[model samples]
Target: MPALRALAAAVFLAHPAWADTATETAERAAADLREAIATLDQAEGARNRIAALTQTIRAYELGLTALREGLRSSAIREDEIRASFEAQRDTIGQLLAAMAAMEAAPGPLVLLHPDGPEAAARTGMILTSVQPALEAEAAKLRADLQEIARMRALQVSAHSALQEGLSAAQAARTALSQAVQDRTDLPQRFLEDPEELQALVANAETLEGFARGVARLQSDIGPPMEDFASAEGTLPLPVVGTLLRRAGEADAAGIVRPGMLIATRPAALVTTPWPATIRYRGPLLDYGNVMIVEPAAGYLLVLAGLATVYGETGDVLDAGAPVGLMGGDETALAQGAGAERPETLYIELRRDAEPIDPAPWFEQTREE
Candidate 1:
């Protein structure tokens, strides 16, 4: 019996109630997911809607991934664990029922009476045999309780994430409607025929072809251009962020793209640093979403990796006008150790279709 008691004590000490660390991590992730959803809900305007929806989707994906990993690490095969718990509970119930029936009769002390000596010995032997089994059951019950607590915590985390995801999806649908309306209400500037523009857009084989087509149309309209050269070293960055990659730096693919990458907060506003005419706005090659603005007659400023864009082609924007927003996905940052990679925006300046270094244009203070 002493040995049995020691074994039970060992089991109890070895498996303390499943630690709350995993659940706490999941809860933290869920809280972030909720905050992201709220941000999406507050976003107004078509451009904001695009940014919000993009961020909301990314948040959902990341939150789901975290919850899955938490569950996998903390509770392997939850279904099997639950089944074992149920079996243990049933056994405990049966044991309790038997003990209760025995209690209704004379107590164990009653067996000490003169006529009950033989019966007392028999009962003693029976109890001795049952002692080890009872102790084992007690140990298993403790394990079951711990497991159930962890499972319950995981369930709550999952439920919260699912609710947040649903809300984000609904908000995205409404935002999409408003975005379409906003696009329709934008004033047209270029006198080019819509059919011709559409055909040109369709026929363009690559981003360069599309840019060339738009340049041709802009040349015909002859929109007023801003003196971008004069603003060099004085212009603010299009978005408030930390510079992560400089122009001429090789990326993970070992390709040196003539552009600078800036890491910004999720759904951060992207603005034009100088007066410009929107020349092109849409997806371009590997750059998820892009906007090409002509700050000068021959110079085009390309902003890429945006989740949402505000201005349409031919629309003239003053210096500091909002153009688009950075995306919210952080998977790029997750690849590096201890890297604070946030949403990134790629900026490129071009002179007659030739890419040029854009670092010289922005203030050094802003870069720092």
Candidate 2:
């Protein structure tokens, strides 16, 4: 199957399960991970190795994310089933005790009631009427037990696949970084003047000022990306993550910023949302490993909090090309340690000196 289709299917694998859905979900996740691993291995020979590796990483992420959610949901179901069993413990005990009584009675006397023949007949009638319901409950018990076992097996199997996928993704990232560096064929629109950029960064007081300064430094000989302005509200998010905060949304400290924040897994791939020229890429002020690119004459996109950056000043990047990877240990997400290794990417869109809400530009950013 195609990469995006695989990811879409994998992401939904963890949706609410019934009798056999959870097991099938785990099965699909495992298969998807294997496919992603295969893709990683084949990426080296692909013409566009960077794009291949990026897709591979995303495949692993979506599968693992779905698998994790499925695991959590399965656990809840297991707990509920156990609780249900526990809550009926007294009833179960009574049933067992009744069975023991029947077993202890002599075979010939089993159907006999000490009271009389009429009472014995009524007793037999009651037993006959209740047998089907009892059998049904017994069958349900068997099914629940089997489901619990299957879920446990699913978890056990997912762990090794998770670890393997994580390791492969890490290696892919390392290779991708090298590939981006080794690449020499990308077109350059203009080279940034180091001194001019340094002066701007040094004098800039806020993000808006820095973005404006970068825009002023851009002197691309080529025309801006055609129809870039018309591409509004159609661009996908540069990375896969949950929207942590919208543009101008306040943080925990009640501080509002122009950029939006996204919560991603460790070492998540960050790509260019559109074809753009790298205006500047490096640590500036407090933003760590920032990459500012101009997708149009007056529009600049700022991505910060990346662990490693790719491309150099003036190199033109195709839309969806890998720009960098989010910071954090890649294995941490699979180990259920994401809370301890939370990685967030800050994205800001600037039109000239004014900051604009990125949600209106990227459709995924508006997802609640």
Candidate 3:
């Protein structure tokens, strides 16, 4: 009887001990989304609207990522719980049938055991013992059913929250885009002539050649960003993403490039890591849309692979200024942020026309 009772208890509480951690993480993720929503609301009145919107968009991204992970854990846990029930289906059916048969029989009939009075008495005791175990298991089963319902509700609500966040973020993007366009307060380092840039672009055969041409075009760009050399290994990544490659590493196509690649979410915002003058901002050979900024006179930070580029050539931009967005369908993100990161940003740093490893400059995103 004890053996059977233990088995029933084990079957009833089949979820692994680790199940609560996932549930708690999911609850915390819900709280994070709530705070992100509040941040979005607070952004409306912030003095620096562009920076505010950038922060808000980032908050939503972090919240959504955590929630997505939570959802995945919840799904795995649910599958484990259901699988437990499925495995014990026969045992549960037998237990229920015995209980039903015992309930239907009269006391006298049950006492009339086929063997004898002594055997009948033993049978009565066993049935009485099983009663408590049966009740306990029934209660546990009810709890599990409730848990399944709760998970379903959580999933539905999480999806709803995701859609709302995505829509709000898109609105923030549009607002930020307009804000960058209307602003005229930024310092213009020098004037750019289209004819000159076109000629440079047409003549250049390699990135090194193109970059050298860009460096030579620098006019009296006032003063360069102060002490850019000292900022190495401490700079924030221009966008929120996971570092995919370091300089000299091979990429998906097995092509080695003197740049680092970062995997980013769809329509993810790209910002400047430091105050710098825009040397060039437009399409370049091989690379898609590109923005090359001069953090200092000889130091150029090149950001490539963008859907849309912002800011104009020779315009000085402060740190965290919106530079561009990674290419991806924004509407698809609303369905659910895909497990795969579809966008990639390529970053390269050069000093005095020599390629310097960009990894040393962006330690922040590297750790993440």
Candidate 4:
């Protein structure tokens, strides 16, 4: 009877260790997934801002350019040019001022008119004065209004884009949170099922699947669900940099393990776009800059540790457009190790969020 009791005790005691490890692993993976989603969200927000600003600037530039060209053919050349050109130029300055105001405003409100009613009223009066046959100032004002409308449309689209990204990010956060909870509950839930506990841990395929999903989520969105295999885009880096750590490796700061490591010239850039939707941009993290491209369902393009992030989210890009610049700072590059210089951008490819050697994918893409 004592021997039988001892055997039972040994079995029960060893069970908790395996459960703990599984829980820890799941929690770590969930956290990494959540962080990646959050980074994407940030990049999208930045892209929206850039788009709004760019659209506004372009509107102002076009209007001014037209007004200047019109002045060249004026019947009352000097007088009309002074009165009309100067006022329109002032309007251009005002528009820029409006941009600054929009920047300072909250959310996408930057797309709205920067000047309050007073500025609009003043501009209206100026337009009235400049509406002579000598210049088509009224037409120009109308064109400016239309330009603002186009910009506002873009901002509206961007707001929707934000909603989608936030949803995905929230999904990732929830998955991680649930995973942590699962870990915490495992001991009690499977207290009597030693076999079950062993089975779950041994299923490395489950872990691999989760990793693969992460990789897929990180891939770029092109033409609405372009499979990793069908999409013909590159890694978005213009310069060749040293490869850093592999996917699922611990980061130097030890904050959390990275999905992948990329080395680049201290300040090089890598760029990509928001996957599937034209409303958000890519470059979601700060551990340098990064871009994820989805060429097919099972593969992802990753470029990390960039110096600068260029290009707006939602903007369609060519296959090899420069997404961001790589870093060249010696102090920044020292984050890794000796003999193996850290001044290179790391490149990686993963299938369904799990890291796979990118070499084959690169070869395949190059051959095509």
Candidate 5:
């Protein structure tokens, strides 16, 4: 009987208490880390891919400009224009393809029913505990996928826009070439045609007026950073990037540099762990590819010069959700060839038009 009892005890010892919770938590954490790494890779990869597309786009634009200018010096060559058009067409097609690929890249999402490690220990005491944890994890994954999907849609839209821009530019060049050809004695025509000269002046004035309207709007709205209390002294760099420039000053071009500039690096993974709302996700003059995120009440964060916009107006974005990807080496719409590198992010904080460094606020967030 004693031997029988000993055997029974040994059989019971083979099964440990419900400590599945701990195992589950460990598994989840590992998965989270892996997911984070993958997401970062996708983000950086998208930026790089977009850069290539931007380069191609720029080259095509240059070709178009040169082709148009060529018409001024020599007779318009039908074969040359057709050839350049074909090349431009191919570049545009490639651009659409690249943008599509970038949009498809995935990123991390919030986990809904994440099981705590204690779930493993309580597995024996609770009925259907594992099911709950599994369900929760599923929900979280779904939520994450949905958010990423929305962002992907925005990328698609941006690509569509570029395609449209390319087509418009192509058409304009085509029309201009035809006009020049129709008018023989081009040199004499240009010199003698008062009407044509007047038209050119009118076009310039129209473009200038449109630009002034935008500038006025920007000044009227005021900077978004005004609501936040001053934390100027200790603002930390959001990630491991260098300061390419500062806020409140122009870069020799007399352009209003809205905010501090920071470059987001690969090694420095800057993430917002909390929920945030996208205050603005549209283009602003001089602030190319910009996003304004409000992480909390009175706290505004601005990310500018992204090659692509990944968020939309009124969308509730989580902290660290991709606002945009950096790419394109084009100078400001107004800035001509005398521009710097195509990369870099311009960041800034304000309590109004008053300028303050964003480093301290970002540093505090990092510490938290």
Candidate 6:
């Protein structure tokens, strides 16, 4: 039983878990890229086309990122295995050479040697004791060889995945560029002076004040030409992430707010999930950077906590057009310090100044 346990331990130690992890990561990245391509192929209209293309680009980028990470991980594992094998190289070589010498001298000859009966008997007993240990060492060597082979294979697979990811990303980018050029009918509900909007956002004391100030600016652009009420339960999220907070949830200060928070990767691209005109894009209150997009008649979409703002106040953005990016990296200033925190975006949907739950507007399956 102890011998069996030792063998099992040797096998376990020979095979590192990083190889499996890298393979799984590669598989997942491939799956994501495939899904992205499928989404783009299925898009029908300009709005859907832009959205799908944007999503495909994002997916390709993410897939490439994951593949590169997997490649790095695989390389590290490979180096570790090589180092371990090199450390044992001399021992394994000596064991093999000793085994070869033993094979050249038969057991019967060693036992019947002319040295003496006592010496031959002692030699036979020593061989008997060392044989099992030698066999165990050989078994461990075989295991190590197998593990090295597996690591090499994993490295090859990682390299292949990286190449595939790069190719797919390049193709996706090309398609995205073409799609952007083909798009023409993006709706624009309101237009505001960038300078005035920036000043208003900078001067606003609270979110409510910011919202009101935006409402005053939008009063001149006339009502939305389209209705967003019919699009309930179907709108895709602006970013790919996990929902952290729901509407009316209490914050650390115990104050309930009417918005949802999404936790996403650092510097994740933010997009308009629907056709909207940019109303405000700047700092407001405690929110780092905010973008107010009006997507429909009498409705405002407030997306805050961004590290960087992209479009100006008057720019009309179609669904999935780039708006800004989430904060967390060095390029985008982190809002909170001391410890690393996951990038989070606060989103709210408002009808004329009143905050409403945006949960019902988006697909339930996507919220997670």
CA RMSD for every model? Answer: 11.6, 8.9, 4.2, 30.2, 25.6, 8.5
Clashes of each: 0, 0, 0, 46, 20, 0
Error of 3 at 146 (Å): 3.1
| Model 3 lDDT tens row, 1-368 | 56656666665566434446566687689779868977887786788887898888778877877887888887887887788789889887766775677688898987788899998898889878777877777776676777778788888888788778877788878887887788787788665655767799888687778877877774456765578888887898998788888889887899898888888888988888999878788888877888888888788898999888888987888887889988887566657655564699999898887888898788764443
TM-score on alpha carbons, each prediction: 0.46, 0.84, 0.79, 0.29, 0.31, 0.55
Off by over 4 Å in 2: 1-23, 95-122, 192-195, 219-221, 224-226, 336-339
TM-score rank order? 2, 3, 6, 1, 5, 4
Model 5, span 120-140: residue lDDT tens: 334323323333433343343
Cα lDDT tens digits, model 4, 178-254, are 33233321111112323432343344253334234344332234344444454334432234333345445567776
Pick by TM-score: which candidate is best? 2
| Clashing pairs for predicted structure model 6, backbone only | none
> Where is the poorest 10-residue window by lDDT in model 1?
330-339
lDDT tens digits, residues 235-310, model 1? Answer: 8888767688998899999978778998775556677888887877877667788888888877888888998887
Candidate 6 lDDT by residue in tens digits, 121-147:
877776666667667666756755665
Q: Indicate the TM-score of model 1.
A: 0.46
Global lDDT of each candidate: 0.65, 0.76, 0.79, 0.39, 0.40, 0.67
Give me the runs in candidate 6 sitting further than 4 Å from their true place. Answer: 1-56, 61-199, 220-225, 330-340, 364-368
Error of 2 at 19 (Å): 5.6
TM-score of 2: 0.84
Q: Give the local distance difference test score of model 2.
A: 0.76
